[model samples]
Target: MFFNRKNLEDHDLRHFYKKLLFPRLVEERMLTLLRQGKIGKWFSGIGQEAIAVGSTLALEDDEYILPMHRNLGVFTTRGIPLSRLAGQWVGKDSGFTKGRDRSFHFGSQEHKIIGMISHLGPQLAVADGIALAHKLKKENKVTLVYTGEGATSEGDFHEALNLASVWELPVIFLVENNGYGLSTPVSEQYRCANLVDRAVGYGMEGILIDGNNILEVYNAIDTIAQSIRQKPRPVLVECKTFRMRGHEEASGVKYVPPHLFDQWSALDPLLNFEKFLLKAQIFSDIEIQQIKTEQKAIVEQEISSAFIETEIQADIQRELNDVYASSVYTSKNNGPSKENSKRYIDTISDALNLAMERNDNLILMGQDIAEYGGAFKITDGFVAKFGKERIRNTPICESAIVGAALGLSINGYKSVVEMQFADFVSCGFNQIINNLAKTHYRWGEKADTVIRMPTGAGTGAGPFHSQSNEAWFTKTPGLKVVYPAFPDDAKGLLLAAIDDPNPVLYFEHKYLYRSLTGNCPEDYFHTEIGKARLVHEGDQCSIITYGLGVHWAIEFQEQHPEYSIDILDLRSLQPWDKQAVETTVEKTGRIVILHEDTLTCGFGAELSAYIAEHCFEYLDAPVMRCASLDTPIPMNKLLEDQFLAKARLGSTITKLLAY
Candidate 1:
């Protein structure tokens, strides 16, 4: 039978002792590496071992863990090879990221562990997403996430708990209140009496426990996890503990009072557990020493072996391998061949409906997307077909939506997110730029997400509703930026973006949503990303543009029957069809860049710079650019009209031709 909290049986002691020993041994070995200058830095979780070891043991194999740097015990308890762990810290080729990323920023999908991004609070929201997936899939699994008390101050901490409670997700958000977040103490961080109590506001439960007590943590989690599996819900756990070391090995203990360390050291988990083993007659003092010795030997052996291991030299070519997935379409012609017709909005709706039908992993989420059918009624009748769970209507939380999408993508779900307006993407900018765009390159992490951004002006939605943000994302690597002009390309490109294995920002020009109509094939067809469509062929000059710019360029040619110019609609911005651009620019010996965004450092700047360097000899004149002024979009009718460059495109083209 089970005894009181703190006391463990003989077999429990055997398993428990290793948990206490492993992190400690690993910490000791890491300290040695720090002395030898082999490792750059180390975050010691010496006193907080119980929180990880206990919680890890309490959860099942399939349950996911999103651990921060301090949760070394979680790695050891989860059966991560000691060598792999040591190799990561030592910067060996055998590391989890193969020397690509720093230690503690690696995860194994096979092991059900999530690689944590530097911003720790975001991990909780990501864990909420993982738990959401488990619940939606009807899988009896839970997710566990670790964050410091100081990190609880981040908006994401509250956002995570709120989302979890709203959805009743099977997730446990553990706050290791180890007194400080780096150097900032908890007293300076929160005004609330206890962090766990905050969970009640989110319609969830909270448990505050002695985090240093391994048995207490284990007992709490073992029961909590079981209950969560049966009835899915978020649980907030506050584990009260202290940090024995400074933030890292190099960071001294000046901030910590000597007396405080002494007080905690006296109650050191390992020493206290040693005393319990001898007192409870679970293991003799001699046996306890033997366990420590064995654990130390293992950690030391791994560390020593890693020191001699060769590191894979950082290769520029290897880093670029998986930026975007391999091309899926084998085009009979250079561009897509359209047979049937559908409006741009219908194409978007049809493409999403078809994608959902084809791949069960694909999920659609946005504000008013469920029963409301979205703001523009683009996803009309989607909820009726796919049901509410798959076609989710989310709260107005762009950051959490994008953050959760990243987590879903990591778990092999082709997450399709809709930002109501492209201008509002700024609300989720941090998640997009930092978490979504960097995940793949930072930690060899998967970021299979499609963010639908309804972009552009001309309809007079003004600054907040009509600004084009495509230029911002094109600057970021590991991101596929798709901006289609015609309805056919919209359907085909959106489909391809859904199938893509990388993060894609699909810009759907809202102005063109109802305004533009063309022959969009009803049958299955995919427009290859990173390929420019030669909308109109001409030899005089090449007009490089995307989205609404393509329409403006074509209109410009119509107005001026004499100016012969080829309009190249670059559907994908990031890995743009540079070959076609090179071919056309060289053929015309002149180029005119047009865009809806401001002229300053726009996507046109990149093109102009490339043309200057790569196509220098072929250039007949300086590349001309026609774009909006470097100012926010105006609501005034005249100002908005002047803001758009469609009227002046003819002048710019004529000037370029004259040059």
Candidate 2:
């Protein structure tokens, strides 16, 4: 080894050598298989196995480790059966994701290993969330997360580090600087002298080590892990290594300079460690040969067993059923209670308070949500009531906060994430759509979290602040969407969303926070999601709407009593009440779907198409849709009013009635 030896025992050294050799041999076998067309592809961790093996071996068995695609040694060091891992690579049903995903793109709760998503940096924030849970539970567990040098440029990297530092969470951010991110050198990735230097900016301890020296890596990580367990805080470690192979088997290493490869080849981790073992008299030549033979046989036997395993059967129905957890729809009431009139905002706050009291595992996170309440003061006094641990005020990092919420859910904690504004969700859209939305579908992990979205356009906060963005998430699978128009519905729906096993987007209209009032129960209650409420019953024309559109329809009907209108409020959008909608379509052959979103491809489009295709025979006219004009909501009051759908409701209804 190029560095001075630490005080590792002989037995520990032997164990490290065995752990390190397994992945290098496995990568060698896999690359041969790829060339012979026996397997699909390979991301060879030929030279950087030491970082994965050493870091993973240093952590406790219960501590979680998040590894990327190239970190095969992490899975091996964690003692996951080689047969099952091989089965994963070959797309067998015995794999972690049951052939749903390939390679290291799956996590195992049983093994405490969270696999990385294709979008790399989000897992860093997820690690923060997991570390946060360990801190909250007073557990001595630490989370170790890995990323390549190129991924450091992602915003999630900065966000996760910043959040972990501010919260003083127990996380080890390991960057395996393997020289290139898909042929882009570190020179082009970042201008910093070392990746660890960026840790100083986040106010965390930083260290650098020679990744080729497994002894040094193990010792440094062990020391840091011990320190973090005692006093929980994040630490950044940069492992300077080189990627010996291309980014993948298919991509050749043509971009690498021959001289650089020759230099790194001389410092190969496996060769250097083997030389160190012989020089230190830890193992003789014959003993080392025998150990290599034994490991090679173990890898070959696992590969052979994997090859004989049953292939994935073509089961379309089973694949479809796995998209979401089975949810029960029920309208629950504790008991008869005195009715109290409350504003929409108060009902939401009351429901959250009651849920937090019932479920001790519930955590609420957002910007200024603790003492300042939220942007609308919904959680104003929650910090004092629930304590700062449960009621957290996060930094302005939506991506990290959302990802951390996911990580918290993985650790059996229910989280409530409040987006300060609905439009700001774009910052964290990847996490919501890719990570949170697909977690359950990919690995059978329920993302038991609720994201509170303060949505709609009546606030006159201009284009950025004002948007009815429920349509964005409604299209995403493995997610539930709830948009309540009234106070009681908001309260009941918020409660139901909290208790839900799937990720839910609860949209609270900003304008309706203090405007609408209704009778709410004093005790806990849950309104059934996927069910529509008949706000007003009629027969001549049917108005199907949600959120602020429901109020607009009600207002139009109150102003024009001459026209008979059936007002239907769809509380939930994803599993919306198709039965109620069909009933109304048949009763009133004329239909007008209303929404506050833009006209093109709005939720109304889905409703109109459903009515046109399924209830075509019952239609008395071409199904009309009333929605806002295709333009941004202006800051001026008059222009904002013009941009909304309220002004056009009368004409759309009159046209439908005339048809």
Candidate 3:
């Protein structure tokens, strides 16, 4: 009675049945393949097929959908070839991720399908970002993102729901309550009577439906999608259903109660839908048999063809090449001759203003960035000039904001996200390393976003507010790291980071924000990413550093005037200036690396090892490293100075000179 035959035409009803049947047959065949050792794994969506198929069919082709591991019906209903899906499951080159990832872990931009990562809750935040894009462009499109009952306990889920509701984005947060999250039952998931009840807490509309009834699912989603398009706002839809199998084929369903299965077996979606069609006279019994036969034959043929396709090759060059979307910028000393004096923070603001003015697709997001002008007031007045839509003031949800920035990047928008401080990056660390850093390598999707980190110490902001964490991202494969010493390099490097079509971590030293002033070009210009600057040239010893360390080395040289030192400021960390570093090492024949982070496992360790390996023959003495003591930064000025590398720089250089 929830589904009326009059609501759909006769052909539409038959086509819907076929769409629902395809995934069921495919899942059945895939399970058999798993048993036969033909495929690696399978997440069977046997009973919950209606939710995936009906929800997918309800949306337009242009709208984006983020589905979970068990949502194969979404792919089939969207008309993805069965052969390609088979290839993906069997790890073939013909698959979306080219055998780099497994199952539905990869996304297809052509299909407008952003697949879920292993961390299920982060994708919800990604959906918020895609919906934010639609709202900004004033497009009549909605983004539907999925989550299971288990992922609801994650902080990202609450953060994403709160954000979408606050912004009133056109999003449908679909929670497929299949009774169990892995082995844990719904009773263990939450205390709420119904999952939809939590939607009211976030100030959004809530709806609950019987997921086993395909007609009801389709009708409800179709209505909700249309309504959201007319008036953009988020809605939470909870589908009540049951998982008929284990979390995956490898895990047996012994933990499930036998009576529950017996009770739900009669409510099977595919079988019930077939019975309804025959009883309603929409299809004869013979016609239903013929449709099943046709779908089975198609599934068989696609599976056979997919098995015969070429397997993934072990090409080391291709694997290495696909890690990053763009090569490092190698050109150096390219700034204009004419310049004007400006402070480091002012030049950063200037570069951002110019980049936003030139590219309408570029947007900025951070805590208090729009109205309060950010924690450092670097973006002061940005809201009035660019409007609240472009200069977004995000909630204090670091994980969701970072995920949303990635969503905007993949959807053809450039984003710049400012962390209130560098130490706070730990909150959103998973999104940066797992999602943004690995997206391109997994699926060849570039994430063109910049995360501005207010880094380093000397401001007495204590352990939480003042810390240098560049080494964390430098070790990540798909990211670029930039740290500039003066105003000129700060402006140019920020511009260059915006121009690159990859994720970049721009570390702006808080100590030098107002302290350092230098001449910068009036017009737009960009310094290379992987190039170093020679601040003071000498032959006594080479001081290799970045951020505040560069200023420390220069200050030492100015005070001594006797020992000539080659001060090399590495502007970037990941693809650092290797040639420049080697040149200085060979010229001076003594190496002294300096940094503000702890001595153990700091970036100084990486540089020292590289110099010891490559430039060992040219060295006159052992490579020396000057870094902060291996302890947390103290709040007191005297203790902080004692903990700093600058306190021991002169002594360290003196020992190296004696060596």
TM-score, per-candidate, Cα-based: 0.96, 0.98, 0.97
TM-score of 3: 0.97
Give the higher-lDDT candidate: 1 or 2: 2
- Once superposed on the true structure, which residue ranges of model 2 sit more than 4 Å away at CA? 2-5, 329-332
TM-score, cand. 1: 0.96
How far residue 127's Cα lies from its native spot in candidate 3, in Å, is: 0.7
Instruction: Compose the digit string of candidate 1's lDDT tens values, residues 1-659.
Output: 12254444678877887777788888887887788887788888999898999999999988899999889888888888888888877667787767767868878877788867777777777887788788778899989999999888888887778888888889999999988878887778888999998987988999998888888889999889999999999899999999999988788789987898988887677777767777878888798888878888887787778877876787888878845545476432345544766778989988898889888988898999988889999888988888888898887878888888877886668789999998888877878887787777655677888999998888777889989888889999878899999998898898888888788999999888888788877766689988999999899999999999998888878877887888899988988988999999889998999998999988889998998989999999998888888899998888998988675787887788787
Top-lDDT candidate index: 2
The better candidate by TM-score, 1 or 2, is: 2
Best prediction by TM-score: 2
The alpha-carbon lDDT assigned to residue 208 of candidate 2 equals 99
User: Is 1 or 3 the stronger prediction by lDDT?
Assistant: 3
For residue 149, give model 1's deviation from the true position in Å. 1.0
Query: lDDT per residue, candidate 2, 1-659, as tens digits?
Result: 56455776889888989999999999988988999999988888889988999999999999999999989999999999999999999988778888878899999987899999999899999999999999999998889999999899999999999999999999999999999999899999999899999988999999999998888898899999999999999999999999999999789999999998899999898889999889989999999999989999999999879899977888989987888877775656656777899999999999999999999999999999988888899888888888999999999999999999999998879999999998999999999999999998888998889999998887679999999988898889889999999999999999999988899999999999988999998788888889999999998999999999999998889999998899999999987999999999999999999999999989999999999999999999999998998998898899999999998999888887777
Q: Which pairs clash in model 3?
A: none
Candidate 1: regions farther than 4 A off: 1-8, 325-327, 330-338
What total of clashing residue pairs does each candidate reach?
Answer: 0, 2, 0
